[model samples]
Target: MRTVRNVHARVIEAPADRVGALLDRIASDDDPLFPAPVWPPMRFDRPLGVGAEGGHGPVRYRVTACTPGRSVRFDFAPPADGHHRLDVEPLGPGRCRLTHTLQERQGPGQALLWSLFVRPVHDTVVEELLDNAEHAATGRTAAPPTTRPPLVRLLHRLGQERPVAVPVPDGARLARTAFDRTDFSDAWRVPLDPGMPRDPRAWRDVLPFPVMASEGDELLLGQDARHLDFRASLLVGERDVTLSTVVRTHNRLGRLYFGAVRHVHPFMTRLVLRRTRRRLALAAPAAGSRHRRREAALG
Candidate 1:
């Protein structure tokens, strides 16, 4: 096994207290530090304090210590031997230094993965966090923004959430009753991230067909063709969005056409949903702007 220590630090123009306060809100609903939507959001089971038991994406860790506005430390779970921490130090009356340090003991396999993949992503995230801290504390970042490499971007895309097959929702009434005799039906769903739009109307562009009907939180779209009549429903639920498809075959010609299409339908639907989710996530307001909006409202 080999031991690895990685460190990233930046100086922010804002006062130490201001930068530290921004750190204190990490993983909160209004977090203005952690880069998210582009990367996985840092999260904990409860709040940002000792014993909070959650980690971003597949990482599993628990907060071991915290000093409110100054520092926080997290220890990794089993199979991983390490701790990562963030600290804020007062540089002067109107300046502060923020640092993130991660140290881990890795086996050969783990080390290989880290050197090839994890390290690049980790470095990017830490830099982005520092950038966010600078922006939230002073309304702008001092340095040029970090740019993701092609490999990192590819890895990020590969790690994107994929849709899962699910039964058509009962709430999708228009889709459920689209055809007098349903020849085929299927549904797939993907989760909605915190800042994603929840209105089904916002997802109307998921399909090329014109909107046929809408109710509650569902929008139906499709066309009646010579071969088959089909309808697609986009339902935005409390925590997820479901895409459902229903088809009615008029005769042997419809059945023949659909038989060939069904094989690729699953792959196409999943790809479309994943792409749409990522697009919308990237389009959401940045965390710093959102935090400022909330503060403005509160004031």
Candidate 2:
């Protein structure tokens, strides 16, 4: 197996010292690299550190070494073979650059997996991590749309998952549930307008687009359009909330639809997360009436 390596880098708008401290305090809160306690379940058996083991979905890795703020490395666990290194370098007084590199040996049939899925997913995930870091340091994150080549676009056309979580607004449970049923759902639920259908031939309008499935904290909704099954689920967690979509193609038409927009999918996912967070922040009134009263009185 020939050793294959890939490197991804991003700049953060924060002091090198701050970024280093932020990376070292890896308690799994808002680390976009780790799965949020939402859908598309991903977990680390324990906290990240030397010898700790964890994986998200089918991906797994074992920490091999660490240097707190400067760098860390993880050796791929069995069934997978690789070394992933994350490091930070100083840029200036209030800025720093970060990099994530993956060097691996394709084992067994791993080469196909790497080319087809792992590599693409890893690319997106690394970018997401950079965004997360910037968000942590400066409260904003963005990059130009990531363009996918034909093969990658074709691969994503059949399906893709965008998982993200945001802090749920206070007393906004009903707002969240209702939003799922309105134009937000319409975005992925086909017609773009699920308003009352006016004509008879509008057969697709008759049934209530499913509020699909719900259990305890999670609520799911979707519409089965002709060419594909467009589905989304919203999970209400004690501390945060999340949504993810499943795009299942029915035939050629679905593939065509997906291929055209697969590149946009990840970008849209980030946009959705940003919007959700902004909305939540706005809707969440400041707590502590005593503090508010003092400011009001002073005014």
Q: What TM-score does each of the candidates earn?
A: 0.91, 0.50
Instruction: Name model 1 segments beyond 4 Å from true.
Output: 297-299
Candidate 2, 1-299: lDDT as tens digits: 87789998888878877667656654353243331221122335677688888755456777789887888787888856778888889888877888889898886578877887768866865664565566666655566534555665555433333334434433333334533333222122111111112221222122235676555555556677787666555544443345445566767888898778766775675555444433333233221122233346789
Q: Write down the lDDT that model 1 would get.
A: 0.88
Worst 10 residues of 2 by lDDT: 189-198
lDDT by residue for model 1 (1-299), tens? 99999999999888989988998899886688888767777888898999999998898899999998899999999989999999999999999899999999999999999999999999988887887787778777778877888998889889988899999999889899888899999999988766678888888777777999988899999999888999999999876899999999988999999999999999999988889888887777667666667777899
Best by lDDT: 1
Q: Residue-pair clashes per candidate, as listed?
A: 0, 1
Give me the runs in candidate 2 sitting further than 4 Å from their true place.
Answer: 25-29, 32-42, 145-299
Give Cα-based local distance difference scores for all models: 0.88, 0.55
User: On a 0 to 100 scale, what is the lDDT of residue 32 in model 2?
Assistant: 34
